[model samples]
Target: MNSFFARKYVIQGIFISVAILIIARLFYLQIIDDSYLLSANNNVLRKVIVYPARGVILDRNGEVLVQNEPVYDLIVTPREAKDIDTLLLCNLINIDTVGFRKRMDKARAQSPYRASIFEKQLSSRTYAKLQEHLYKFRGFYVQNRTVRSYPDSMAAQFLGYILEVNDRDIERSKGFYKAGDYIGASGVESSYEELLRGNRGVKNLMVDALNRPKGIFSEGKYDTLAVSGDGLVSSLDKDLQILAERLMKNKIGSVVAIEPSSGEILSFVSSPSYDPNLMVGRERGNNYMKLLNDPHKPMFDRPIQASYPPGSVFKVVAALTAQQAGVIDQHSTFMCPGYYSYGGGRARMRCTHVHGTTSLVHSIEGSCNTYYGHVYARMIDSRGMSGPKAYDLWREGIMKFGIGQKLGIDLPGEKPGLIPTSDFYTKRYGSTKWRSGYNISLSIGQGEMGITPLQMANIMAIVANRGFYYRPHLIKGIGEKKIVKEEFTEKIYAGVDTKYYESVIEGMSRVVNQPGGTGYSVRINGIEMCGKTGTVQNPHGENHAVFFAFAPRENPKIAIAVFVENAGYGGTWAGPIASMLVEKHLKDTITIPKYIQDRIFNANLLPAVKVAAPKAKDAAKVAANTTAGLPKSRIPSTLRINADFSPRVNEDNARVNPLIEFNSQVYE
Candidate 1:
């Protein structure tokens, strides 16, 4: 009886302890933790996301290039919506009844209790109309958002475009972005996305049974304000960009102009470009499809994407490299008897004229292929070096001018371009069989060499700075502080000594200033412009006209490169365009004759557009059409050269100025 009583007391003690613990836990949750209460009142609470305004983009002069315009998204909670007039709601949001049902089904699929976007990017008029009758709808509300707006409607490729975030974009953002969020897809929009897209905030509100917002939940304790994104001051010059676009209007090519001292890109133009505004609003997808289908390829960003042979413009790099290697000097003479003979006279590279004894400067001015051929031969074979070793060293020297590699510009889709390595030659032509003569076309900037307009322009900047250059960039400042990144400010040397640039500069100067120089026709009267003209050979069609220049000679301000596709000579098209840009930037006016401006403005070099779309089987044929018969590795896959388009020059104007004449004998 005593043992039984002791066991009973122990069991009673355990029961009493458990009851007390349970009561204490309930008391703590009810009195201290309000989170449980919030969960219990979930039916009455609502969470709303507040989106911040996207950053504005300004030109270097503080002119607004891109800004935000407000729009609305119609959101709905399917469970809360009951016995509503579906047709009226659809009419208010400018959607059909069928569309409304599909959206409702989609919302229910997402979460019946949670709100989702029913319709997005509502215009101001629609939002105003919907706001008056929104009380009639139980579960629908409007959420404010902003879309990008380009006021000037220019720089389609540079400014880029934004689209709704995909699954990949959301995953990459690490839960920061969800469905229905917009993200930058290309160009500066993509490059500075984080700074341009500001922080999003949230607000908790109390709602009635009708789903109408009553007031802030817990008296605004859970509310957070949205912070607008920081504005960006771009390096682009609005006027210059506009002029470049105008000049490139009917042509097919690209232009890249940079400020030599700061490496700020002033003007970037890719011809056959569409207005940036087309990439905005509800019509964006349709417009994008049209642009994508257009044969001219307005969507391709040529400045950083299209890689063409540098042509005679590359001779400047050859000259510097030859000087550094001690193969040539200011007075070094090469005999050019109309052509350069190599492979024991089996191969001949023709020249424009028979320059009997051409000096280093004269070689550049005249663009004598024979002079460079001899100089390159000596540089490759002399000094008791093997051809492969010498060639690799030559490539290294050329790459220092920002060639054969991406200059790390503040843009997307930059290609490093093609500069074949000695290993590449070895793979193609066996180890010991390939000699300097096998790839001598490299001396004149052709055959396996490719360069984008951006890199070419940067090369001019290197020369303008006398063998040093800052990395080319598009942004000048970020936020109100106007902070420039350290990478953009750092000076990168081109690996050539300063002394080597004088003779090259003199040759370039003569190319513009002297009568016999190739670029003499396009020389500005007052400004001492140093420029080189290049007529790049194209196997598919007419040669590409190319020019690179820096102006005022001393303390140069602007450096530029221009390429005109299917145009016969650089002096006729590319040189004039570059000179005009220089004049406009420095003098802020066009002092050149009206004929010069008219020639570029009126010229139509665009290829004929195909009326019928290519079939599925013919797609490969269409893609290969531009670079037919050329090796895929040699050129950019997207590079489109018009095989049949002939450049039509005004014969009347050509006769008026003998310097503007396109001479068949003159080939670079």
Candidate 2:
């Protein structure tokens, strides 16, 4: 009996030890190790990202410039897409089986179990057809999203466009963005991307054994709400913008208009602009390729990006600086026998016209190079310092007018424009080798000096405001509350005496209204318009036509600048356009001569560089390759206009908008 009891106790001890070991193993599986739990959860749960709608952009007059349109994206999960009807699926999305397989293979390389976009930007009709048969394909689902659409074909450069996020964008987003997500690429879209993109949401979902979504997990216990993006009220005037586009059509330069009082951009036009719509939807890649390959560079934002010699416009700066420096005054006179002879009368700077004796006012009105040449020399020699020291002071005074620096306009890709310092000349010519005579071209706004059209417009605004200006910007307010930033509203003063602006304004006013003024042909009948014209010297081609102006001398409302590349004298092409644009904006109608309007409208000033469009066969190949899911109805025309506003088709077949697209819904 003793022996039997000892064996029984041993057996009981063995049983108790086995029970504790089992309990410990269960605890390790349930709590200590997370890998198994994570794997199990991955197989049973799905996290869906909810993208929010981008903001709508509107003109100051409440006309929609940019809005959102619903587009469908076909998403697929490789793990659950087994046994799909490959042929039927390909036919449904308008793709070949080989293309479909290639897309799937590429997606699988990215991730096998993760969901990715298989086809993007399906039209509404395609979406309708695909939605019905989506259930047939187990792992494929249709997601409704929005893409940007332009209501009117205007402001292509400054309005900008959106593009798919790449690896770099994903890394910069701190996990906010992933592959297939869209982000603003340039222009206002890029500058205000945060306010325009809004917040994304996430929804936790339960999945079946096959990795198909069953329903919302725990009745959306962890789901977040997607907030719609804020809306932007821009300072652009739709009517003025349309008119500017019409005037600049077929040209190769830029037009910039500003409101003097508010410093709001009224119209910004870069000619050879592609239709903003062309950069949207599935064809963006091909359209972008065409624009990029074009030699004229329609994608290049000329208003803020192209820096040219300010030409005679810099004479305005020269006059202002000279008066402020006490080097020259309104009564100061210089004799111009059609040129200024310097370097012991060996080197001469020629003037276009011979004004016997030119004063400050007459120098501007007649655009005499000799008068400014003398004034610039005097200013450089005013202070009893070295040429470099005086040049530094002169540059400082010029920069106060917002030249040689970024104007801080709310746009991307703005060139600061070159305003060379004393050191620049010193380095180029060496410390002791150069003098004022060597750089005399700068007196007439040539040589190393460069300025953008927008900066030129800002200079006009400063003159109109009498030494004060607001930073030029695109946005006026944001969201429903109409909130405007204080920085945009604050007045920035150019450090020049208010007393001197009148003399400059008087000279500019004579430039348009006076009988002998160079800009007399562009004068309006009933308006007191102040203006200046410039012929930028271009060594490679014809001179560029440039002009800037403001209207109604008392309490000026509008200020503008126009630059026409390789278009000859400013008074010929740029002056009329700038004056008519002013009339259209201020009076809402253009009463300018019909012959003048027609001449501008019919001119084509593009360089020899033309972008060749893809051939019919090549376009067909692109259609087959890039647009996998989009139907034939959604594909844009293969033969389209290039950057110079020249068409690939006959003039009869060329697409044209009416002269006016504003104040009428029919324009849409």
Candidate 3:
């Protein structure tokens, strides 16, 4: 009887121990660990993301260039979705029933309980119509978002375009970006993306069984407010940009203009361009493919990406280098007997005219090839320095002018262009065999030297500032504080001393003002413009017309570079266009006759042949092929212009008659 009593007491103790353990586990789950509680709350409460509006881009004059337009996205939680009118939902969102099912399956695959996008970028009209019937469809809600809108529909490549993020972009952003988030792909949009995308917020929303938002959960205590992106002020001048684009309407090349003192880009144009609006909305993919397949390559950024031989314009560099090396001075003279004979007289480079006893100023005014040839030879061999050492020094001086290197412009994909080193020549022609005469074509800005229009324009700015320049930039200010970067304000010297620029500037002045000047026909009457003209050789077709200048000569306001492909003489096509740009910028009026303006406007220089459009799957491959493996001096020959046009002159105007003659010559 005592043993039975002891067993009963032990069993009672065991039961008590088991009860205590159960109570402790219940306490831990209910109070210490909140995961289950949070999961339960998620069933009734929906977490919605509030997207902030992207920043608006404005011109220097406060004119809007890019702004945001409201759009909506349809969100769905597949777990809450039940039997509903799928057809009605499809009709409201402008999608078919099959598409709705596909989207629903995708959402379920992602996560049945988590919210996912169903239909993206819905128009306001569709959202308005869908909102009234939203209560009828379970597990679906509308979220507000924004897309970019361009008012002027210009600067397609300058402003760039935005597209939804892919796997790589999402990976790059870490956990910040989802599959449907938009990212800037190029231009100012890309460079300023971090400041322009703004901050996203979240709200805990209470919803009914129908998935309609009833009210803010917990009286909005847990919600965060979205902050809109900071506004950007660009350096672009709206009127100047418009005029530049209009002047280059039918041509195939680029134009870049900058304010000399500040190095702020005023006008940027790449011709054969399309409307920026085509890159927005739901049709972006289709339009992008079409632009990729275009024969003229309107999408290519010619100002920064396309590299070409600088032609005779490079003589400016040769002259500057020779002067800096103490090999030549302003009064230095070289005899030109119509050609420069080099390589022991086996080869010759021809000049346009037999200019006898050409002085420094006269050589530039006449675009004399023989004079620069002799100067370059003296610079390389006559100096005590060896050929390779002198060549390196020459390249170093040219690079100081921002050639053959990326100028660090705020745009993406800027080509550094090509400036071969002494090592490159050593590999090509062996060490001792190659000499100054072997690469004499470089004296006139040819033979393996490549320069982009942006770099060319920067050279003009350096000359205008009398040897120093601020880095060329597009953004004038950022945010409401109007903060400008310090790098853009710092002065960069071009290695050449200030004193040397005067003689070169005087020669450039003569190129526009003097009677025998190559650019005289295109000069403005009241403005004291200094300029240079280049007829760049092309292996595929007609020579490229090139010109660069700074206006009013002293305290120059605007410096510009214009390149027209297959346009023959530089003074004829490029000089006139650049003069018009300068006139419009400084005077706000074009003083040139109406017939001269009409000549540029009416010219059709685009290629006549149409290339076969690549299939969507092969678009990228074809685009790569189109831009690859072409000579640097010209665009792809398949897209070469067939129409050869010359400026039509009015017999009454004697000043304009000089354009009829080809003043600049090219030879090997």
Candidate 4:
């Protein structure tokens, strides 16, 4: 009986202790933890973010290339919006009732109490209409925003388009950005994003007892003021850029001009370009699609990304290397037949025509393939050096000129074209196994070597300077700080004997000044230019015309490169273009004789004959060197092509109505 009584007392005491602990826990929750109450009250408060305006971009002269324009986005909160005549409201905004309903449904699904954009970037007329009738649509409001604008109105590919930040970008950028923030996507805009994207500002307003905004809290003492981004002053020249674009109309190629001594790129032209204004808003993706799908591939940065064999342009390099190696001199001569014979067990290299015995200068003047072929074989195969063995000396010399490798250029998408090394060949064919005969084409700037037009211009700069060149760059400064290239600013010898370049320069000068020079037909009168021309042969039907030159020979100013596709004979097509560009740069006008200009303007250099592609062991993967077919010598000239045909013109795509149908005026 005593044990039962003790058990009853212990059970009663335990029950009382449990009751007391439960009451204390409730007290702690009610007094100390306020998450539930705070969250409940938050339903009445809202936070809104005010985005900062992005920075502007300008040319070297402080001309605006990119800037912002104000616009309005129509927003709606379904639950707060009331007593609406849906049809009248839709008519007022020029949106259909069905469209309005669809948007409302979407907003309701997201959150009836939260605001969402219904229609973005409304026109001024529509915005004005909305402002006058805002009370009629109670829940609808307008948010101010900015869009991109371009003035002088041409687009360079590097000034990439901008768009609203997507979920993916917001998530990726994480803490530093939000979905509505603007970001630079390409060109200088991208490269200097951090500098160009200024700091954002915030404002906190105090509310009255009725939840109405009264005034800024302490005059926004805690708010951060937005700072405008520093402007990008580019190296581009306005007049030259416009002229290059106008001249390149309907052509599929590129032109690059630079100060030979400084390597400051003055004009960069890529044809079939679009306006940057098209990339500033919601329709950017659609506009980009149109340009991207264009058969001309205007979006591609050909100067930086497209690699072609230097063709006979590589001959200048070979000639310089040969002279530097002491294997030859300025007066060195080689006999030319219609074809060049390789020393031992090799096929004879076919030429367009026999150029006769020519010195190094004459070789460049006449662009004698036989001369370059012989020099290449002798230089590489001299002393019984294997083919790959000869390539090493050649490769090393080529590398010094910034070929077969990245020149450490400032632009994006630059390619380091391939220059075969002995190790590379040894791995492919075996040590002591590959002979000069294995790749005799390399001597003439053919075979496995490839280079871009930008590199081609850079090479001309080196040759013009007689052994040194600056690194090619586009931006002059980001505000006050100049984008100086530390590497090319200081002269580098390029590891070549200066005397060797003089001989090549002599040949190039003759090519322009002498009647026998391949470039003489298009040569400018006042300016003495030393340059090489290449008829880069194409796997496609017509050959690509190409030229590299620098003017005012004794003291050079401009170094240039031009490529015109499907245009026969570099001297005929590319030479004239290069000459015209040179004249424009030197004199700011076309100095071409009326007859020469007519010849150029009237020449139709598209395929006159279709040569069958030879089937030989995967020619598809052959080295990317461009094939250049010289115009036949005067003695046995092919019927010269004259420009009688005009490029196909599409009137709708032309700029007759940029004012009435500017993207802002249309796709909106």
Candidate 5:
């Protein structure tokens, strides 16, 4: 009986311990812990997003290219926005009642209890006016933000523009972005987005039942500060870019200038371009649609997108490749009988000027068609190599000069210009049937070759640097830390013998400085400029004019390429413009006569050639119609002669348009 009584006492002690533990837990939960109590009151908490300031963009000279201005986003919670004067609120925001209801309904569709944007990107003046009447409109508030502004009104394509993030952008960003956030859409703004967009922050505050902020929750313990983005220092020369844009105002083409030593683009201009400001604010969508619909394609980035035959400017490559391949040298000589007759008299390639027994230098100076044709044949059919092997070697040499491939510039939408391979010709005309003579047109930078203006400038840069160039880029520096990317710092070699470049350089110098040279008319007084003029054939109308040049023979500064569509001879239009730019950049002032400037500024070719679209169907038809008896290879793809024909005009009525038609079966 005593043992049983002891066991009972032990069980009673365990039960007493459990009862005390339960009482202690209840006191801790009800009296000491308030975390669960706060969570239970969800309507009293509010989360606010703090947007960081976007990065700024400046030119190489530290001139501001892009900046930001303070703006506000008007937000509203539909459920809490009751008992408000709808018409009064509409008048304060400068919107009609219908517009206000539309915005309200749009916001309500997103969420009734949660806050959504009713209006965004309001200017500081508008925000200030709305601030006075905000208290009268319940559940409505203003969120601080910034919008991009271009102070200089230039480099619209390269500087790029920003737009509100779409569903694709937000989904790609995961939790880092929302619908209202802005992101870079194009140009450098899009290329370096990660470095330019900074981290966002958040803050939590206590709110009353009326949706009014009470105070900072937990003494601001959950708040985080926003960090501003990194600034970018671009490689562009603001003054040069402005001048190029001004010069190209009435024309349709592209101009690209670069610092040969650093590969920094001094200027990039595409004519018929729209103002960057047109892409800003509420009218951006409408303006963008208009620009998109325009016939001239103002939004097109032509410097790196539009490709054209290099024309006679390609002779330098032929010369260098000839020397490198051990087929010709500076002293090589060839005779031209005004035309090169090959393929048993079935083929004839004519030269504009008779250049009989010419040296390598004279060939380039006069842009002798026969001379380069012979050299190209020798290079491609030399050293006992087969036609395919020899042609492949020549093409590889050409590619080294940054042709037939994209230069890997920092900008977007760069095209890899075409360089027809031996296989391409062999496939088109079987290996045994095709020979060096079948591809003679390539000697003078014609036929299947197409290169962009950027590539043209880069090729000139390679010549300026004695066969090497940094990949062309727009950005020079990033952030206050002054960091630059490694690719820009690295040097790329053009894979040619340095000794061969001197002769080519000498020939280029004479093209501008010596009399009888194609570019002699464009020579400055004492700049020692080296240049090449190209009169590229356009299937549509008048031939396109092109000029590529670099100044100061020894240590070149600026290397530029200018292209003027349907402008006839290169020296007539392109040469003068390029010379003017070179003179202005080197001397910081133009000493050339005012007559030259006035002529280029007043000249307009768009009206004459506006109706001629670049149609490939017409090219074959024109070729077949114009050269009936000549073999396909013999009939030159581009008639590289001066265009002196005038468009037909009505003699009876001055205002009546003339009708001159070319028969598809015959040329009249």
Candidate 6:
């Protein structure tokens, strides 16, 4: 009986011990495991992120142009969100109830714990109402954010728009980013994103039983404060930008002005531009899509993207190259019976007029096409080489001016205009039989030649400085801070010797200050300017008036390029615009004859904005590549005209409105 009782007690003790161990193990799994811990963390401590304020944008003179304004985003977490009043929320926020429901459903599908914003950029009036009724809703809150606003509403292209982080952008940024963060989409914003975005901050909160955030539960031990983006100081002159924009009203064109001594881009204006304020947060997608499809391409950076034949302005480059190569000197003369005849039976290269017995200087001042024809002939023929060899010489001259390749500008999308090379000819004409006569338009900045306004402006900088130019840049400083970049003082040469540049500068000076010069009308009484006129030919049967100039000759300060599409004669349209820009830069006020300013300010070119569709898309790109500086393909017979096309002669421009597509709806 005693043994039996002892065995029963031992078995009971062993069974009890096993049961206790099992309970302890269950407790460990439920309370100590990471999954359980994560669940607990999700329930009580909601993490709210505080985004830093974006930096303010100011002009070179420290005037604020782009700044951040306070806005609110309506945030929610689906698991905790038992929104009691959906209709009121939708009504207050201007979203249809159906749209509100759809958004909420989508948010719920994304993640139960992840917070999603339903309404972006809530108005002050709506925010006040929500703040009053906030306690009525669960897991619904308002988070403070900022939206970009342009107070002055000028310089749209320079101050690119902001956008939400896309999947691609997030992937590129690695794990540091998520959707809904604002990012710089274009212009200065994109380039300065790192400095302007600042650090992401967090506020950790301890909540009570009711899920209300307790005030500073750990006394800020777990909080990381937000830092605002640094302030920016751009190289732009806002007054000048506005003046240029206004001056260019009603015209399709671009104006690029640079400080010759420093490569500071003072004012860059591309017409048919929209106010950047329209591109932020919720409005961004719609506005951008509209701009993306707009016909006039208002979003296009005309200064850097639109390539035109340098036109007569190209003659300046031809003369300079000739002088540099020793093919011609300032004193060298070419007889112009208003034409250059290669095989003389009947094929004289036509000139605008009969300029007889012209020297290099006179040829430049009068823009003698015949003189360049003779010069081209000498470059290719003097070596007793084939047309390809002569084309190579021409290519060398073109390359010297920073044409045919990106000037490597700090600005995005700079298209290097074309300069022909022998390789290009070989590709086009089988390298066996290609002649210079087949591409004579290149002698006058036409045929396959193309250069952007920024390059055109930089060429003026090169001419003004007499040898080299700093890379054209729009940024001067960041947040009252200077970027110690080499570009600020970096010297870029246009491949001309100093003596060659001086000779060319002298003739350019004569063009504006002398009677025979085409741009004499732009000659200001007290100021001296060296100017060149170019009339670019387009297949649309109209010409572009292009002018490049730098002012006050001795200590050249400002260089400018102006382009007026189909406006006729560089002297008539582009020259005056440049003159006004120069005067504005120097005097801070332009006193152009009011009637002329008003007339040009109101001209339009919408009818000719669209060209015939190319048979293939890459054809234009190929053309641009070939013209800007690709080796001359023995270019198969392409379309071209061979004379100086002075535009707007005897044509009325008062009824023109190139700004037909300034608004996104119409343009896109």
Maximum-lDDT candidate: 1
lDDT (10s digit) by residue, model 4, range 348-432: 6566567677788777767776787678767777846666666776778779888887876566667888787788667765565
Return the candidate ranking by lDDT, descending.
Answer: 1, 3, 2, 5, 6, 4
- Runs with alpha carbons beyond 4 Å of true place in candidate 6: 1-44, 207-213, 344-346, 608-668
Listed in order, each prediction's TM-score against the native is 0.85, 0.84, 0.86, 0.78, 0.83, 0.84
RMSD of 2: 11.3
Give the alpha-carbon lDDT of every model.
0.85, 0.83, 0.84, 0.70, 0.81, 0.76
Candidate 1 is scored at a TM of: 0.85
Question: Residue 21 in model 6: shift from native, Å?
Answer: 19
Taking every candidate in turn, the Cα RMSD to the unseen true structure, in Å, is 9.6, 11.3, 8.9, 13.2, 11.0, 10.4
lDDT (tens digit, per residue) of candidate 5 on 1-668 = 99999999999999999999999988887789744444344346778888988899999999999998888889988866878898888877788988988998998999877789998878788888888888788778778888788988888878888888999999898877787999989888888888888988888877654445688888888899889899999999898888788777778888999999999998988877888888887678999999899887888888989999888778888888788888888899999887665566655666656779999888877788778878877887665778888788888989998899988888777899999888888787655445567767677787778999999999899999998899899998999977888898888998878888898888899989998788888899878999998877665666788999998888999999999887778888888888888888888887667898888878776633233533665666665577789775676535312234554322211110012121111000
Q: Which window of ten consecutive residues has the lowest lDDT sum in model 4?
A: 659-668
661 Cα displacement, candidate 5 (Å): 20
Q: Candidate 2: lDDT over CA atoms?
A: 0.83
Cα misplacement distance, residue 238 of candidate 3 (Å): 1.0
Clashing pairs in 5: none
Give model 6's clash tally: 30
- Give Cα distance to truth, residue 117, candidate 1, Å: 1.1
The superposed Cα distance between candidate 3 and the true structure at residue 595, in angstroms, equals 1.1
Off by over 4 Å in 4: 1-50, 75-117, 123-125, 135-140, 166-168, 171-174, 205-217, 343-346, 383-386, 422-432, 481-492, 594-668
Question: Model 3: which ten-residue window has the lowest total lDDT?
Answer: 652-661
